[model samples]
Target: MATSAVPSDNLPTYKLVVVGDGGVGKSALTIQFFQKIFVPDYDPTIEDSYLKHTEIDGQWAILDVLDTAGQEEFSAMREQYMRTGDGFLIVFSVTDKASFEHVDRFHQLILRVKDRG
Candidate 1:
């Protein structure tokens, strides 16, 4: 009798956050990564979570992805989300100047919320 060689159940899990200004393709990018589908339209996101299994260099890992709303009004809850993520993907459309400007702010906020210098 041969036991299974894959230890999928033992793989580590990571919490990832995708953040950017509104309409900056944050959701589309996340969905594409998890489902292999590209969404052509834009819809505002409040908050969304996704799970996906990925393998890299013969190692398996599970990802818990969080998609965040880009609107400034949701800024109040940003700290809470920041605290939960192990990593973040900050996105901004090359054509959108306003969105580009806010990237630094988001990065700063994440550091502050996570209490990292």
Candidate 2:
């Protein structure tokens, strides 16, 4: 019997959540990372997920990334997703002062939701 180069089972999964103010490029960043393309359009994202299998530090793993809405209207959904995230990426547009300033709020919210102080 031939052995497969990459195992199909028992791969660890890392759940990453991206958050930031609207138009701060959260979706753009996520798309670029997963799809290797730049999306200049600014369509609001409620929530989007992408999955990939790759090697990490010589071990196979799965990357499950969640791109979340930056609009205040979707704030209620933040905590729900944050609770399951193993890591987070707080995005902000340097050109937008307000979005840059709101990074702390997003960080604090994540800390609060994850009970990580």
Candidate 3:
């Protein structure tokens, strides 16, 4: 039997940014995905980041997920992080209509900052 070794340093990193309105379960979704736990309480996040080594499409890669603050006060920092993200997960709470409606805003922001438009 033979084993092939993959170079650790050469592994591609995918940066995913989670964005949404406050209390929209952005942190909860991020924490659950990274830590495998459900947090019922809502704690406003300024910013949080998680890194993991995982296999994607049968190839190993580094997953860098940024959990961002959804508060208006943190809006200033949105562009800073958005500029660094390769992709984004726009989260919204099903129970909160406002959060759902603002999804377009977040999407637009990401596009504007990323210059994807």
Candidate 4:
């Protein structure tokens, strides 16, 4: 019989935060990856969700995924969390190049925040 290639339970947890515009499907990606469920046309309904005990490379992760508002009103709160996360998933739509441009600014902000932290 062929042997299974499952990893051991000694991997470290890593937090992955997705940040981007409203219609870019950050919520959908999160749901798809975490819940293993997918919808053809899902909305950005996740304000914040807890994905407990996620395993990556045999390590467990308690991901506190904070989905910030895509609107301009939540900029402050968004910046606050961006500064605090371990890493990020800054996505942009291929159809909208403008959003792609803004991702750099956000990426720079995260780097700055994490550097200071």
The number of clashing residue pairs in model 4 is 1
Best-to-worst order by TM-score is: 2, 3, 1, 4
**Residue runs of model 2 more than 4 Å from their true location after superposition:** 1-4
Using Cα atoms with residue i matched to residue i, what is each candidate's TM-score against the true structure? 0.86, 0.91, 0.90, 0.74
Report residue 96 deviation for candidate 3 (angstroms): 0.9
Report the Cα RMSD per candidate.
3.7, 3.5, 2.8, 3.8
In candidate 4, which residue pairs get closer than 3 Å at backbone N, Cα or C atoms, i.e. clash?
Answer: 11-59
Which stretches of candidate 1 lie above 4 Å from their native place? 1-8
lDDT (C-alpha, whole model) for all candidates: 0.87, 0.91, 0.90, 0.69
- Between which residue pairs do clashes occur in model 3? none
**Per-residue CA lDDT of candidate 3, range 15-46, in tens?**
99999999999899988998899999988999
What lDDT would candidate 4 get against the real structure? 0.69
lDDT per residue (tens digit) for residues 48-114 in model 4: 7555565454445455666555656666777677666777889888888888888988788788878
C-alpha lDDT of residue 69 in model 4: 58
Instruction: Rate residue 37 of model 2 by lDDT.
Output: 99
On lDDT, the leading prediction is 2
Worst 10 residues of 3 by lDDT: 1-10
In model 3, what lDDT does residue 9 have? 85
Best by TM-score: 2
How well does candidate 3 match the true structure, expressed as C-alpha RMSD? 2.8
